[model samples]
Target: MTYPRSLLRAAVLAGMTVVVLVQFAAQLVLMVPGVLLGMVFLLPPPIHAGRVLVSRWRRMFANWTGRTVPVPYEPPPPPPEPDEEGLYRHESTLYKSPRFPAFFHRLDWLMKDPATKRDLSWAFWFPVLGLLPLALAAGPLLLALWTWVWGPPWGLPGEPSSGAWWATAWTALWERPAWLAALSVPGLVALPWTVGAVARWSAWLLAPGVRRPPSAKRVEQTLLAWVRCAMLVACAAAEVVLLAVSLACFGLGFGLGLVFLIPVANSHFRWLANMRRQFAEWGGVRIPRPYTPQLRPELRPDGLYRVKNNLYKTETMATFNANWQWTWNDIASWRDLVWLAADPVVTVALVGAPVAAVVYGGWGLVFPWVWTELFDADWSAWYGAVAGHRTLGLLVGLALVAAGLAVPRPLLVAHAWWTALLLRPTKAAAAEAALRERVERLTQTRTDALDAQAAEVRRIERDLHDGAQARLIAVGLTLGAIERLMDTDPAAARKLVAQARETSATALTELRDLVRGIHPPVLSERGLGDAVRALALDTAAEVNVAGELPGRPPAPVESAAYFAVSELLANATRHGGAERIGIDLRHRDGVLRITVTDDGDGGANPSRGTGLRGIERRLGTFDGTLTIHSPPGGPTVATLELPCALSSPKTSTS
Candidate 1:
């Protein structure tokens, strides 16, 4: 799914505003540090590094502020590329953001200010120093209030007749109405000062001419800016609402969200924050998700699983075909089963004698008489010693309980590890599914192309025999009659000749139309470049083509490409209501990429449109693939990729 640049900008700006507001508000209490920590993990390495520098300086400033405020900062390391995988250092929940480094860096740059420095020391220590009293008093004052209100007299704790003098004294001292007033005073002053400093920094950071507009201009722009901000805020709100709904759904059903729900939620929040900051900086906004966040887990045995049953069962094409999904069974292969067994630790534990001992001890304790009868010991004495009010026995009993709980953890972990190890091959089967999918896609595309060609051939043959050819045959018959009649009667021969000419013209026109529909003759004579231009010129919508083609391609290749463009444009004009279209064709690294983009009412569904289906079919003949990028918006792009060398078009001029 994709969003329009304008609405996307607005959504981003709104998110930035929210992040800033939340950060500032949290600073008033000590919640800012956690949020900052979360943000730091969300941001890119460079911005995080810059923030670290700022943080250190802020701590220095805090020391001068005559207050102790630990301006904390932790710089994240450089990010891994998109495809790299594995757990992160620190076992950080922050790592959950699949695109963390990229996402956060964009956000940090958007949210950063020169006024705060790279470390953000000033922002941190300033808040800490300014709100030190409020921060320090928060815990004790709450405790004092709790005691004063729900003191011993109000509860059944020692049943005190009245509130303690000390409790009242402490409450009066720390929880005074004046302190609340004092707490608010710093915020009022700090708000404007911080805002101004940040604003000045922002003005300096942007290009010289890119200053915030003057009062009059601001007033004029306020409405639009507000609208943008509102839209972006709505996007953030939508994210939160969707997250909650998804969580609720997960909880109600199989609880797929349980294993990684918190992490997913955190990652999503970070993503939204990053998105918002970028938008806000650019004076843009983002909109709520047009499509639902439907992330079904890809089946993997070792990785997180969606369901328990899918573990043992193999994957089948039928499993995926029903829902257009590739299931665990379909991808699961015998080769991966060996890795599965080797990876799981279950066998090792089951063979160990220590595990058996622990299990026997627990079972024997449940019915001590059985052990006593077997051992010929005094069960009652042993039970009394443990249960009686005695020092050694009581301690021993507690130790036994502690040991019972403690011993199980490592053993359970080992068991799970072994089980998972045994299941490694199954997991490998799931992981290899992507490779299988790539192969299948190639095969399917080629099959589709063959089918399309067969259909096209049948169509052409039908048109020729039933239409132009039959008409031409009649013309030939008329000419033959005219030739014979010419010797007998010249006037009659002239009349027959005129009738043959009319039939000849009609047949010629029909043949021309049929040829044009089959594969435009111009495409074969000129090449893809001129063919596309011609096709675009015929369309009502504006077309902008970019990229240079090197020499002419094979006839079959050019024709297939031309037909694809024609079909896409046809669809755009007939159903899309698109005003403008962009066609980009490029040959890079020995592969041909054809991209067709349109700005119109989006939400184009491939399943519902034959034009797109035909494009897919055509590309399939060459083992090429079509990818649709359409959301409910004003723009959509359809991309076609083909292996130039592997797929040569098949056709017969005859």
Candidate 2:
């Protein structure tokens, strides 16, 4: 039963392999024309078809192996929507019809997805490897058929002998009929193993999320490092050309007065430097851009715009001059020029040398053997050979390749250090950059505070109008009704008075609740520590408060800290599924720090929750920061820090 089942599965896999081979051939045929002849429209269809085929195989293999294969492709882009003008936009151009934009979007989607390449690879390799299992399963049947039809070495009485040389030679080789039958048994026994092997190999490439074996991962890393080194070498060569062009442009702009070309060259080549800065991360260093902010022309009170000392009545001329001067005066611009001049020499020597050694060494190892042995060519002293000793050359080549591989990662780090030396901002420039960032953050926080203040005011007004004011109006009407009812009936007048009293009490409670929402009474009277304790009493979880401040924080800071803790507690209970929580408060080094830790299923993301973002904004008003460390399982800890002074302890007030 096992042997038959294995053969059945093998036959099905073999048929699938044929389909995969056809798909592979179709893709190769389309890819050539699509890439070379600009028929990109031909590319997506074959890739999409290949994905469908691969997806089916992935499911079958997963079912057979009882292991999951996650879908590795990114979600497709949303369909294009027309703007107010009823035109769809794709990149820079707008079109009346959605067809062109949709096509381009789909093309981008398919080409950019890594899974598509993996599918194409699977398509190519599966057909070649799939033949093994197919041959194993089918070999026994072929041998049986051959022996039955040819009647072993000697022809049967009724069987006609073949006169063909190949048939006669094949019949002569199989002397015994039993040997042919015996050969089929081993293939039948190996069928199941081959099938499992194919399933395992297919899953490795198809499942991107699957953890690779250590050896495979190490090899991939080594190859990727080599690729990165090669890319750096190529980029260094490109930078040399850019440096020459930049020098020429600077000469023309400054020396010959081609002022327009100056900004063009500066702006265009700046991206390459920025790319290199980004790539510097591979070397375990980060390089930030050093250019100053581009400020717009400020309109003066004298009815003119100022660019430097120069003033223009028209805005356009002033703006252009400002940009030109800004670029020209930036110290970073000169630093970039210097970097462009020096990068080629440094990068080529540091990064390129290893790659060159590897390439030359590989050539010496493989090509020399091929030329000397296969073609019987004379050995040359060039390459890795020494005095026509091919064996010596092979050994030298092997060592050189190993040496080349060993040094690329370290050399890459060295290259990054060199990049940082030229491209990173100077001390003064870094300070200015920090100041500019501080100003920007302050501006944003101010805007947020204003918006929040307006929203709070609107909320207060709505509550007053809809709750307290309406109840008070009702109380006044009831009192007036009582005035009328007193003369007619004393009993009804008494009842009306009682109803008005109850309504007034409810209104007062509503007003107090609204005030508490604005600034909690406990926070003002008892300070932040006692207020947070009062907050914890109302929460669902068992909360333990630890640590104490020596004195009270400023009212505003205390209020912000209280509310921030309240929000964290609420998040822990509501979303984090916390059962127990701990709150700690301290004033250390003039900074009030509050830590809230919760034992919960903790995966808190501030960006996703408005409660957290509101807490951040409220804290930001006082130059406070919220940092959370929430791993997936349990125990989320959120720390809130605010820089403020603490005053002497104040007496509790009613």
Index of the highest-lDDT prediction: 2
lDDT of 1 by residue, 217-243 (tens): 655454443334334435534554645
**How well does candidate 1 match the true structure in TM-score terms?**
0.37
**RMSD values, in order shown:** 23.1, 8.9
TM-score of each: 0.37, 0.70
- Please give the lDDT score for candidate 1: 0.51
Q: What is the lDDT of candidate 2?
A: 0.81
lDDT tens string, model 2, 357-449?
788888967568556643345665675476676667787787778878878888778888999999999999999988988999999889878
